[model samples]
Target chain A: MDLLSNLSLGFATAASPENLLFCLIGVILGTLIGVLPGIGATATIAMLLPITFQLEPVSSLIMLAGIYYGAQYGGSTTAILINMPGESSSAVTAIDGYQMARRGKAGTALAVAALGSFFAGTVATLLVALFAPPLTAIALKFGAAEYFSLMLLGLVSAIALAHGSILKALAMVVLGLILGLVGTDIYTGAPRFTFGITEYADGLSFVALAVGIFGIAEILRNLEGDQDRTVLGTSLGGLLPSRADLKRMVAPMLRGTAVGSILGILPGGGAVLAAFASYTIEKRLSDHPEEFGQGAIAGVAGPESANNAGAQTSFIPLLTLGIPANPVMALMVGAMIIQGIVPGPNVASEQPELFWGIIASMWIGNLMLVVLNLPLIGLWVKLLKVPYHVLFPVIMAFCSIGVYSVNSNVFDLYAVAFFGLMGYVLLKLRCEPAPLLLGFVLGPMLEENLRRAMILGRGDPTIFVARPISLTLLLLTLAVLVVMFLPSIRKKREEVFVEAD
Target chain B: MKNITVDWTDAMAGLIFILFGLLFGVQSLGLEIGTAFRMGPGYFPLVLSGILLVLGGLIVFSAIHDRGGEGVGKMAWRGLFFILPAPIFFGLTVRGLGFVPAIFLTTLVAALASFKMRPLWALVLAGAVTVFATLVFSYGLGLPFRRFGPWLEF
Candidate 1:
């Protein structure tokens, strides 16, 4: 009943021998994928989804959750030791992390990242346990109109946050929405865009889409360039951060945690935004900002802490409201559904052990990550030394097999190929795929909610504005759009976009 | 000339969108429903098509005023060659080869498309993947793999 007691029960469930072993396995696998370039948590989890079907619901969720956050921890290692970011979330880490590596402080940068992540994971897990209940209650007040409006805001924010031309971003989002609409309509029971295919009836599998876009497409992109773009620093030195490094990182870490916790709760921009935002804030706050792009320890510590914190707290919205903040969380929700556990407001009450066990497992999982990663850093650094020609094929093979295994249907394999081509084309055109994917995922829900609200109000659209929550969300969307159009914001956006290029 | 081509892709995308919208609108005509407010089979598709048409038109309009840089035809043909053949390979082999072998072969071919590799090595990797998949799917989880013909032997 009480917070402490519930957590104790959670610890009991999570600390069970079976759950602990699975948690360790999950983090280890997560780290391996994270260390290897081009294999992201989304594809990795999708590959593992079918394997988890036989496990108990609690065990399955705990393991999958471990992979999700564990990838965030592992992702920073690649970003630091190599210039390559394992996922978009770690892109900011590469900015200064790789710099630290070049300066022969790779050990210190990595230690800070690991320790900061562990600290953030502990605090965020506590926050999730304390805050989830009230958030679920607040989420219950949202009706179809409010949910639709919130999703609309999310789509807009995704487009705005995308580092590219607004027109191109908008186009990609619309394309994603069209793709999302391909499955049978839930409300009308009408076959949409399935084109007489049985497999399409369920819609394009998110696993296939993600694997094709992020994993397969990444392989294709990597192959076009040099095959041996290894990071410069290969030497492994001290494994712990110095006292001077710790003193400098404290303020940035705290600021990053605060920023990450809030932004992580938003849809479509969780860890990615947290890392970037923290880096910017840290640079702005630093007296010696010029040292950032060189080898600033604060840069490594802040973004790593923010990204990990963001990854942990992103589950709050998913667990409480049934809204997945990002694609990886969406896959997690899919995993929960396969286990016959509906994720929403009722999840905490109906399945307290499952919920709390997962919460408690985060602490244990974080501990496992530190132990697993610190010693294995030498090994991961060696992995970074492997030539890209050999690595790319292996990653591509995994992507193809992972996508194919999802449905036991060849159609998804083809779907992945098709999307991979589309993704490649989009990349060539300098169009960002992140907003597009977000839009696609949210589109069907947005349309369904919109239609339902309209039908309920007998075609009067004012019902959207009449609802306080919906009105507020709609206003926020408008404000963001207006701000984005401002000259100052536009200039800043262009700078960010250029830097990305 | 480059600017014209940039306009052309935007125009092409718009035309495709319009065509797609028309197709969906046509398809919606055959669906039957009971009530207006409750929504029929055609309602959502009809709405989507209409939105697509409007958005496509906007794209066309914006392309006219756009001053963006010249768009190059930078399509990666090697990537396309590797990716395009995947579905055909999957479709042809899945039923006969079964899921495990089918996936292995598909992955092997897809992996090879990135660059030149020894055929023997590819075959070995493919075989290893097949065995690993067989163990994971069949032995571990007990998903009945279709071993022969239309029916599963498991």
Candidate 2:
């Protein structure tokens, strides 16, 4: 009855005309970004964060959440039609989905992806509703030391999961942490790294950094070697799948959902891992394993289902402990701050409507995607024909406008250019920008918690080990680092990233 | 002579990290570094800087040890030349020329980065973008922006 009441309350908030309208707008915009290969949801969300400032906090969050998962649906479309995943999570979907398109089963592939995603999304939503309350209760008891260790575990795992040299990822994280220390210190109002610029007294702008590294940097990378994206010229064969096709998809969809839901709770890009895991599992489990790379029904169904499930469950951490599971979640943290809501365990209790409204909106958003996308597929195909040359200029103009509107600061614009250059250099050096953004977001909080914990423990380094929860978290962090450094695991990790590239 | 080869990408990356570490480390020393019991603004940053330095050195060592690695790929010099400055141009001119002119010029600059874009087409694209942006952001959303700043006065 309690769960039912909570559900009704959530539905009540999400079903409002105004909230519904914003959610629709968000899903549409997200799908647009998803169809376009040049820009990403992270950048789109960053650009829109300023615009969202005018709406109710709950509405803004609902719209933002809509965009995140809507992209998952949109990404699979491109994967099937163009062999290019607009989002990284759909990279695996491209493998078999594109092959299906070539064989005139594009409609089947698209249908399977959509249906699987919807089924998986429903299950994940229930899981979130079931599990979030319990996790928030547990999070309420965490002290500063425990929080510090938890954040340390997060940072370490992020580096471990990141592509390229672990040393470089570690360096990037430390570099991010240093950049975060630019403003005046909280404990003692002394400016740290302002370099005599008062414009940076409140620290570097998060929006500027995000837009630069993700938005402008992506533009420059694409421009390096401009190439064409192929869209399937044939009309969609059929929108509805045959009964046999649906029957074949049943087991993989279930299995993918289960796998994705669990893996998504882990830190460091779990949705991406979930999709890849689902593909590998389907290949192994398939009766005709040879059909995998050549176009297997399970191939498109499983990963899309798993990826959606994973994307939904990743919100569990941000909603519970205020820790972002990936870069997108980090932006949510920034968004929450902008909306005057400090994201933490208290958010659930203090603003139940805001919390539950977002959860409810996800379901509404998923339903909308399923309803709108199949009919809109033809429209998206037409959109894919738009050349990239004209697009980047508009993107550049938008990035400038979005970054400027944050605080009307001219210096932030300068920072955008500076970070864009840095981001490009980092890309050429084969560094993953995701981990740095994660580190940047977590840096100030990590430092603050460490100092607070140190003071609480009277300057004793053993304080971390003295507490049970803190000690356990530190041990987990150590284990992740050790496993990453192991010769066999390191080799395996390299292979995974190579396959991804 | 013994053969000497380096992965320039890794070497450059390592060098950037080193420079960043040294810069922050030296800067941290200028502030008060309290004892472990109480961290000053400088203590945590100094410690992080040390980790960065060690990590950078390890990266450089690995890069030197790596053999037959792919060299740094072709740089996007043209893209960098045009794209990076577009935002700076906007920042400089948005206050003077106002929203319409600033955004138009910024879009024009960015469109030039691609080799496929012709000058006239770029101009048309920039103009279209400016009109749309002015209509949506200025009129529809009602962001407080001057259509024309004082610098445009006759």
The best candidate by TM-score is 2
Please provide, for model 2 over A1-501, each residue's C-alpha lDDT reduced to its tens digit, 9 standing for 90 to 100. 877888888988999999999999889888887777756567667666666666899999999888876766777888899888876688899999999998898888999999999999999999989999999999999999999999888888878667889989989888888887889999999998899999999999888888888877888888988766667888777988899999999999999999999988887758778888999999999899999989899998999999899889989988999998878898899888878898889998999888888889989999999999888888888888888888889889988887887788889999999989998889889887878888888889999999999999999989999999999999999999999999999999888877866
Worst 10 residues of 1 chain A by lDDT: A389-398
Cα lDDT tens digits, model 1, B57-79, are: 77667667536545636555675
Native contacts kept, each candidate? 0.20, 0.89
Residue-pair clashes per prediction, in order, are 0, 0
| DockQ score of each predicted structure, in the order shown | 0.35, 0.87
Would you list the clashing residue pairs of candidate 2? none
Quote each prediction's TM-score: 0.90, 0.98
lDDT of 2: 0.87
Predicted structure with the largest lDDT when compared to the true one: 2
